[model samples]
Target: MALTQQQRVELSSLVGDRRVDAVVAGRARMVLWRDEGRSAEEVAALAGVSRPTVNTWVRRYHDHGVPGLADRPRPGKPAEVPGSVRARILALTRMAPPAVTGLTHWSSRELANYLARHEETRVSHNFIADLWRQHGLAPHRSGTFKLSRDPAFADKVVDIVGLYLNPPDGAVVLCVDEKTQVQALDRTQPLLPIDFDRTEKRTHDYVRHGTTNLFAALNTATGTVTARCFPKRRGAEFLTFMKTIAAAYPGRELHVVVDNLSTHTTDEVKTWLADNPRIVFHFTPTGSSWLNMVEIWFGIITRQAIRRGTFTSVTRLTRAINDYVTAWNTDAKPFVWTATPSEILTKVRWVHTEVRKLLTNNDK
Candidate 1:
């Protein structure tokens, strides 16, 4: 085949370019080799392709130039469901199932059946599943959220986030909270130890030995926890825990973050705060105890130490907790808070707007 100087350069570039498809590059190589006086069989052997493939590409290049080396659209059947039908299917998936159907959410098979019966749209469950996967829709899954109705929600968020991101110098910021009613459960049977192919298993049923409450103070600067277990989660116990925390870090200003639990704001607690000139309490917004960093530590301890523990008695449970706390303090690192108050409030506002839109649509 005869070739222009530009075509020769393009084919040579395609053969040497790393980004070009291997098959395209091979085709380009065969055309180049054929132009360089190589026979069809030699080019086929060099390109690891049949002589027919080499001849086909050489013929295509002679007719159409370098673009002929690329792939062509293969013939296939058209789509069964139109765009309108797919849109309707997605819209219905977003809605709660009709009361008559007695379904909380729409399953793929249920959606397919519903569409066939009511909308006169025939689609297989597998097709519906594929459509959902392509669009990243999951009608079967639900997530939970709570909008804080606290009048001072913004102020509290700013205050807490400020403390997290920029604490006052010469003062210790402590996220204080109580993890109440931590059960000391004893399994009815011995825990089956894990093997090479088996997970560690325990009995479903357990004896309730007792329950204890943990009052924790997480130091935001150093991640050290001052924690104690109490028989009851009362104002007096909280006061005692506060005193212990004070004694732990003497002569330092303490800003303690706590939830708006009744026990946390009792008259006794108020009097103690008044007496302690160095300590101040900052209450998290209502229903927003997640702001307390100690809650993160609580989750860590629950998963690591308490959740699967065989505690025959409360003492054993408390001992296990203390042991874990000691081990944790030995090499403690602070949990870094990254989100700013503005970022959090912006997301919250977006959620609120979406919720309002949903409610308005439901009313219609």
Candidate 2:
């Protein structure tokens, strides 16, 4: 009962954990059947099943090796381009706007087409999708994005953000940003219920009540949030946000991190800054709004509180947002980051690399 050279390789394929693989290996054993290799009754008793099960395993062993037993992640033809091309595809994907490739936007199919024609890399849209999943560049729906004018923006923001990572005792770390154009959209008719099979849908022409600006300062220590809702976002509006923080905690030097929007740096804002000696403004390098923690939090509100929600008017939207904020503040705690300064720096370095090696439309 000596095994063949092919059987070893077959065993290797079934070495990994899988149901059928284990069964194949179990049946490949020499002891499974009697000396005459009578598997009929032995298979029925041991497997508590049919005679064909053991016979199939014996027949398969005579045919292919372990690779035949193991399930191949891909079943079709190999690509013209190897993993290097797949890596290239990912590098292209991480670039801010995938549209520069004349794709309007990237779907896996578009990427596959680009690869097949340009790189001479043959792949299916399905394979491109697999690549997308691997790279964490899903871009399902307008991923949170911002473009900075400063070439040194990521480094600068990383430096400012580092202050929070290793903050001094009793120091105030504030994430300040403006949420502009928060609107109130009222439906023509109140949202009506639908059948169990479908979701509620609304017709166009919903009423727009009005909009408001939210200037918020998140206290990194106490996990408290202080915000001001204004008709417009201006230096004046930002001052109100700062003043709210000032009143809430007197005698604390505040470390406020804000975006580089013009309204946040108006002449009036600069004037207010001169008077506020205790306030330190840590501006996220221009165009790096994602560095603002509030923006991250705002996304949560947009998804959970705003998206698909029907508001009767701007006032209604405003009230709902404020109400959600009030309720949120009552219990919401600031997110704690465990990533060390080195880890954050490492990530920013990669972002810088992404910008440097950005794949152009031609690179496809």
Candidate 3:
């Protein structure tokens, strides 16, 4: 729906400013009241503004017309780092480490020094940082972020999310991932097991008995979790896990969403997939295991079932974990995620440039 007359005037004057100016905002109501079918008092009450404020907007509109209600031009010193300086900074950053310039890695201080001496523009490290920030460049932390380059990334993303949002009419949607090296530990102090009144558990500190890999699948529609303990989580083990999923849902085409682990996409596995069309594999974007619902299930297992529990052997650890998973399945329910694809993509875009900074120093 289009905005109301009152809303338009208020928005124009408040666009650059963070908050609405009460007086200027009230004038919007006055302007609305003068429209073909509204009385001044009625418009004031409807717009939740005082009559004087309403009258002001109407009077200003009459005097200056459309641009009258717009915000005044904001005043500030023009940027010292003009277009030429910004272009030079970007160009320098994209070049090799400053060995040619008789220096080492481009530190903030060094870059600022070079700019003032060589480019004839003296600027502080903070100013250089701010300029780089405005362009979303931060080489110091550039490698920490990642993005996908799949040609069919968008379609694949929609398909993956759709499995959770609206699965096939009859089949179940399972989000799956592996949790590796889950250390079985006893805390430094034992936790007393709590009853219905409390959730704390008794524990005694014990040396960690190595680690176990957990393969988990969460039914998104039901919130039920099915887990398995494996010797080691390699491609062969992953193939076995896939077989388990197939057997679990006999005669049904199981839609499985997994991460981009190298083993998960090996040639043998791809051959198996080709041979069995019923099992569909949807991969999440690279470096986004957080998007997998099975990760959340792992957290629950850690908090409610595993932490502080004393286990001396793999058998006992396996039994305790199985008990927890069984109980969880009986009471499982789907998690609510309302984050829109647009919202996620917007956040990704904001970090895209900073992520690209790592590409600058090395052409290869």
TM-score of each: 0.60, 0.61, 0.53
Q: What is candidate 1's local distance difference test score?
A: 0.80
Please list the residue runs of candidate 3 whose C-alpha ends up more than 4 Å from where it truly belongs after superposition. 1-153, 191-206, 353-364
Q: Sort the candidates on lDDT, descending order.
A: 1, 3, 2
Model 2, residue 231: what's the lDDT? 92
lDDT per residue for candidate 3 within 1-364, as digits (tens), equals: 2346675655455432313333444444346446646776776665555777667667666677656765556599655556656666765553434544564235456687787777687776656666666767654332222355556556666777677777898777788888888876645543322111121233333567778999988888888887899879888988898888888889887888998889799888999999988888888876555567787777677767776477777778888999988888787778865655666566566555643553453345
Clash totals for all models, in order? 0, 9, 8
List, residue by residue over 1-364, the lDDT tens digit for candidate 2: 4455565545544432222323444554422343345656765555444676656555555566444433346777765746566767776565444444653246566667777777687777656766776666664333423344577765665667576677656778888887788877665543311111122223353666778787777777656676667898777777777777777778877778887777778887788778877777888875556566776677667756775478876677777778878887889787665555466556656765765665453366
Q: Which of the two, 1 or 2, has more TM-score?
A: 2
Q: How does residue 22 of candidate 2 score in lDDT?
A: 33
lDDT of each: 0.80, 0.62, 0.66
Q: Which is superior by lDDT, 1 or 3?
A: 1
- Cα RMSD (angstroms) for every candidate in the order listed: 17.0, 14.7, 17.9
Candidate 3 lDDT score relative to the true structure: 0.66
Model 1 bad stretches (over 4 Å)? 1-145, 189-204
